[model samples]
Target chain A: MSALLAVDGISKSFRGLKAASAVSFELDAGAILGLIGPNGAGKTTVFNMIAGVFPPDEGRVRMDGRDITGKRPDQICRAGIGRTFQIVKPFGGLTVRENVIVGALASCKTVADAEREADRVLDLLGLADKARQPAHALTLPDRKCLEVARALATRPKLLLLDEVMAGLRPTETDRMVAIFRQLNRESGLTILLIEHVMRAVMALAQRIVVLNTGEVIATGTPEEIAADQKVRDCYLGEEAA
Target chain B: MAMGRATRMLIGLMVALLLAPFIGNDYLVSVLILCLFNAYLAQAWNIMMGFAGQLSLGHALYVGLGAYAGGALFFHYGTPPWIGMIVGAAIAALVGGVIGFLGFRFGVKGVYFALLTIAFAEFTRILFDHFTWVGGSSGLYLPVVRADHDNLLLLRGRPAMFYYVILGLSAAVFLICHRILGSRLGYYWRAIREDQDAAQALGIDTFKAKMAAVMLSAALTAVGGVFYAFYTNTLYAESAFAMHRSIELILGAIIGGMGTLFGPILGAFLLTLLGELLTRLAENFGHGFEGVKQIGYGLILLVIIALRREGVWPRLAKRLGLDGEKAS
Candidate 1:
């Protein structure tokens, strides 16, 4: 089967600094890919390029064989790419349901339709009880769930999650991993996640891509990645030390 | 129940506004007209600043552009004020579109964007001060028709006529604002206001949404400008496009409640009435109270910011059980 998303030789720079350089990856439908890197390893930058936050200096991003490079973020979203920020971007003044509804409205023709879709997504995320509460009032885990629920409401074919488990406790992280597993297995949702939590990555990702200094250093299954020398020397080794 | 209560309050307010002119005192009617005019201008300014979260400290640019457009047409060509008003609004919208396009397309935002607006207003004020066609610095004046003549077509000088005209305008603007606050565009604007990047990530075209807000606000403010020109029979670049005029437009929205539909109207009424009362007191005191109104405004603003940061309307709405869940 063909890949659902193809990132081909994408590179980006800010001023004189190289953020991402010629990074490439491919994910088949329903596959979960874990992106692991050290701090400022350009993982989020890669996600930004894919999500159209900014155009790459050189490269192409393709979804379902259609070139989507350099489109506005909103256009890319409507073209079926949904993402959550590393720093959660909640509409602080709006209710949780309203935040999701803003996402749902991208696909819905009317507010009623959008609200219904938002409610369903909120229910799926176990956030229905907090639907009317303002987003700023949410706890961190709940805020993360709200972010996921908001992205999911757009019904994207491919989801880009940036640091979803960053601030969660171990139990909370495990619960989220279980939810991710269910979403991938049952709904056939394709996910590309950037995670610092190695256990969650190892448990959830079918394939892993390790990045260092804006370049892909390793790509393999979880066991193979754990055994890779370069990954250990560059990333896991530093983490352990 | 909340929706019903809000609707009832809105209806009651409309009825009260409709019946105000029947009080039959010229001074009171004139004050009421000024109150409605400020409310209309505040509503216009609110759409851009409150709803879209674009701070424009020089919105009088649109107002002055509009006043000049309408007044020039009427004075130069003998055209009716209604036609002039439409043309004036269009001119203001065009200018707004240009400013918005320049700012949004080039990525000017926040306080810098506000400075851009101020710069534009200041530039235009200087240009209008020297432009001979519109009477330059001396100011432009509409033909002074007697109050008894009551030329509805020309919008001639009559306190009652001006009162009803502005009252109608205030009500129409209120309905338009209500309709907009309930629509899809309103949601987009609110999202953009809260966070532009997140709004864009959620598939909202933030630039277009904000531009729409700016243009719509400019168009509406221009209409108010036309009303001001015709009712007062005078326009000067300094007074029409002044920074203080822009502040006056914004203060109503801020004091009543920013981002709420009724906030601007409530603020406008409260401020105008207070100004009138203070002026009356100053007259009675017979000296040294010349700047008391300005001092009073500053004090009121300080109090609002310190005590109730959300403004009066939201608290009032909550008390009356009319606070809807929607952000607006």
Candidate 2:
């Protein structure tokens, strides 16, 4: 079966620094993929390129067999790619529901329809209780969850999450893992996530891709990636040391 | 469901405004007309700054464009003011759209965007100052027809007529703004206001939404300009396109609680009333001071800003149990 998303040798450079270089991966339909890396390994830059914040300096991005390279972020969003920021970008003055509704409005026909979608997404993300609160009032974890809820509201074919579990406690991380697991299992939602939390990554991702110094260092199942000698030398060994 | 206190209060205020000309002398009625004019202009300005978060400090450009368009048409072609209003609106919208295109297309934002607007306004003012077909820097004058009968069609005659016209206009603008603030477009605008990158990531066309706001605001302000041209029977580039005039247009929206439905109207009334009251008090005290009213106005504005950063309308609404779940 063909992959749902194909990131073929994407590279990006800023000024004299290379952020990502010829990094490539494939996410199959209904599968969860983890993108793990050391700090400045360009995980978020890859997300930015795929989500169309800026075009990759080289290489193609295809979703559902359609070329989507170099499109505007809004166009990419409507083409069914939803993404979360490493730093949460909640519409602070809006209510939680309204923040999600903004995302839902991309696919929904009307505000009423968007509102219904927002309610559903908020309920799914366990933010239903705080739906009426201004987003600025939310705690950091809830704000991160709100970002996930908003992306989900777009009804994406591929969800790209960036560091949502960074500051979360282990229990909270487990809860997030469970939520993502449910989303993947029940709806067959495809996900590509960047995470520093190894527990959540191991618990959620079906396949793992490891990045180091702007290149894909390893790709395998969680066990294979953990056992890979090159990955250990470049990333896991540093973490252990 | 029962009607909210805010709605009831709004209805009462509307009724009072409708009856004001009948209860007052010409001077008082004219003052009320001035208040409503400010209210209308502020409401127009609010769409760009308050709703879309695009701060335009050159709103007088639209007003001046509208006034000149309408006044020039009437003076040279003998066109009725009603037709002139439409043409004026179109002209203002075109100019506003250009300004918006330049700013948004080039990604000029925040304070830079504000400077761009001011630059355009100042440029236009100078251009109009040199353009002699419209009477150059001297000014453009509309003939004061000595018609015994009041001509509503021509937008001329009595202070009371001007009062009702401005009052009807202010109310119409309020309803228009309220409607926009409740729609999907309004939600999109608010999202863009809160965060542009986030809004874009959510698939909102921030540039288009902001452009719509700028053009609509300019069109509405132009209509007010047509009204001003006919009501005052004159238009001067210096007075109409002045930097201070642009500043005056935004003051009400800023002080009344920007982004709130009733904020601009409330702020406009408060400002106009305070200014009038202070001027009257100075006259009564036999001081006849040139800048006392301005000093008092500035002091009050500082107090308002210092005390309520969010503006007076939100707190006032909360006190009256009129706060709704929606931001509006």
Among these predictions, the greatest lDDT belongs to 1
lDDT of 1 by residue, B1-328 (tens): 7777777777897787778778558788988998999999999999998889999998999989988988999999988878988998898889999999999999898899999999999999999999899999999988886678788899985788898899889888888988887678988998898888889998999988998999999999999998898988898998999988998889999999998888998999899999889999999999999988888889999999999988899998888777664644
Q: Which residue segments of model 2 deviate by more than 4 Å?
A: A238-241, B1-3, B285-288, B325-327
Cα lDDT of model 2 by residue, A1-241, tens digit: 8999999999999997999999989999999999998889998889899999999999999999999999999989988989999888899988998899998988899889999999999888899999989999999999999999998999998899999999998888989999989889999999999988888888889899998989999999988888888988877875532
Interface DockQ of candidate 2: 0.89
* Model 2, CA-based lDDT: 0.89
Each model's fnat?
A: 0.76, 0.88
Best by DockQ: 2
The per-model DockQ list reads 0.82, 0.89
Give the CA lDDT, 0 to 100, for residue B282 in model 1: 98
lDDT of 2 at A85: 90
